[model samples]
Target: VVDRLNLQAIVPSAQTLQEQSSRMHLKKLKTVVTYWATRQIITYNVPPLAFIIAANTNVNTGALINLYSDLQKVAIEDLFNKS
Candidate 1:
């Protein structure tokens, strides 16, 4: 599941700039689905926090650990049910 995480946010600026130089361009961007798990306490009043970070950039060790921890809270049945 970790391997399946969409890491598109990590595209290098240089690469993006180069791509923009080409004739092709993105007309629309959309996210059909997104899944994230976090260990932080879940609450009824507060909403879950989901953030997308660049893969090429250095991810804070603490943030990465927290993400993995949160992901564990998701039940296997629930995850599979999403499909």
Candidate 2:
């Protein structure tokens, strides 16, 4: 569906709503509030354009993106071990 709509980037900003750890509550508050603010500003002030860039993700997602590789010895061995 996204490809059909020609949407290049789908910021999962709201994905932060899933944060459930007490340790991450503060960070979640910041992320949700920031996303809301940006959404409001863009919705009322500036309209979407062809080349506009946006981002959306929490710590886990951010770290996943930054990870260079997921290849692992255990993963490879498991793949070959008919389970």
Q: Which candidate is the best by TM-score?
A: 1
Evaluated with lDDT, which candidate comes out highest? 1
Residue 1, candidate 2: alpha-carbon lDDT: 61
- What does each candidate score in C-alpha RMSD? 14.8, 15.1
Q: For candidate 1, what is the total of clashing residue pairs?
A: 6
In model 2, the runs with Cα more than 4 Å from the true position are 1-56, 60-62, 66-68, 71-74
- The TM-score obtained by model 2 is 0.19
Error (Å) of candidate 2 at residue 34 is: 19
Query: Number of clashes in every candidate structure?
Result: 6, 0
**Candidate 2 local lDDT, 1-83, one digit each (tens):** 64675332333333442342233454422222224322311111111211123334333544432321232334445556956
Native-referenced Cα lDDT, model 2: 0.31
The C-alpha TM-scores of every prediction are 0.25, 0.19
lDDT by residue (1-83, candidate 1, tens digit) is: 76886544333343443354342333132111111232121111112432333321233444544554455455344556777
